[model samples]
Target: MNSSIFTPVSPTINTSLKPHQNPLILIDNKRVACARARKHVTRTKALFSTTKEIVLKEFHQRRALKIISGLQNLDKYDVASVVIAADKGGATHVDIACDPELVKLATSLTSLPVCVSSVDPAAFPAAVEAGAVMVEIGNYDSFYDMGLTFSPEQILSLTKETKTMLPTVTLSVTVPHTLSLPDQVKLAQQLEQEGVDIIQTEGGKFSNPSKAGVLGLIEKASPTLAAAYSISRAVNIYVMCSSGLSSVTAPMAITAGASGVGVGSAVNKLNDVVAMIAQVKSIAESLNLSTIEEVVFEESNLRL
Candidate 1:
């Protein structure tokens, strides 16, 4: 068992009394009052949802590695190899496109939970029916190149409709990193209110910031990180960080407050399946170590 990886977070609160108020009365003060308010609302809804058994279970019990398969015009053999490697490499879940045949093939090849991605709400139920353990509203990264835009209202509506349509199946709604950081946070909070099981943050198309090295990495990941930080603080449900993420950047993601991280180009671009799995495992290990270290350090300081 990883002691550091799953340590519970301690809650901290600071309060001050206003001179104008009764001396005995103290008011709570925090840097992010709105976030706390949102969290309260989300917790209430989550309680209700849990009572109904609409809980979103994390598939990756140890550490999660979600292998993305089936790129544009890719062959079935290639997809099969990816699935086989994912299974052998200890992938927690596998994500495939909405193609029917590919879903069938993936399910037959790997017992790992399978997730299917599509932008249309109409495709969600069908994907679930086809044995997708989870469904995501994504591939907008590819669509953004063609001048497509996904608005907050549109995303909220899709989430509501999807939940109403498939109450049993888990739904992961992708928050477009294309939106401003505030907008991303707003949409995330709204999604939680609308009964979205998971909120996945993405950032590939809005801009490419990796060529500039460290500064590039910061620019590329900042939006998604901000969204993760804000949304995770505001909601108790899972938030999966993604887009332009590599082994180097994955740990930064956990530090920024993501429940899990998703990778595609880093793993998919590799020709060797074993290398991909190794990279994924390495990222998960690093996150566990970092988390443990932070917890230990905080405890030591408090004792001092």
Candidate 2:
């Protein structure tokens, strides 16, 4: 609920983005991010894998993984299947609908933290009561499919209202990737002032790459990546780069300034559980190590 929550757990490192130390603490214990991490070696090919046994214990060091089942998805069986895959695949957490029943079901299936997504500020309290560790107010992709879009003011107002209702709960607000880059940065700063704990950026829904293969994939991830790079420098809170992200873009998000990434559709859309787990492992591995040393923090607070 407060900035102090992340201070003790996340370690500090210098980034080329600036000479000064940047805040690395992203999620705290409230998000059920208390997973213990240890490095182990595989004898098969002399490979080293840093297993994400528990991520909450060290989410800041490694990019946190959140596999979402979708905000509008109400089917418990479908949601449970995704939850099972997320856990078996070594994901740090799972995101599901705000329904208390779904929350309960997800909790029953996995030890990971459950994050409930809903635009209705009122829906959060009950989900929080039902065992959701974190509450997200935006997963704009689902709403956009229905021709609904939120204004900057509306998102800020929702945050204020949600914060009032659940003052002590860990809250993450999404900056609608639909907004212009300048507008998104402005909105991110405002959310921080409102005491929003984490800011999630989304752009996959807006991007439709023209080319095929890697070029297309990068184009698809461009929206969120651009927003992540610009917004992370302006705010001192946790930035989650999500949407249109794949194993290819996951590492790019972390290097861009996001303390972590939230991957939906990419993992959940797959029909096979093994495929879903493989995708999760691929994305998690991308965040395990990065060559980008410095992330320049540029403060550009444009007005909303």
Number of backbone-clashing residue pairs for each candidate, in the order shown: 0, 8
lDDT of 2 by residue, 32-57 (tens): 44443222213311221122123333
Taking all chains together, each candidate's TM-score versus the true structure is 0.69, 0.76
As a TM-score, model 1 comes out at 0.69
Q: What would the per-residue lDDT of candidate 1 be over residues 1-304, giving only the tens digit for each residue?
A: 5353213322221223333443223223343676798999889567545632422343222234566763342468767767776676555677778666778888899887777787776876666666676777765766776788898888878777777876656778889877887888888888888777778888754656756876776777776777778888887667888776766776677777776677776666677767766765665555563355468899999999
Candidate 2: regions farther than 4 A off: 1-59, 289-304
| CA lDDT of each prediction against the hidden true structure | 0.69, 0.80
TM-score of 2: 0.76
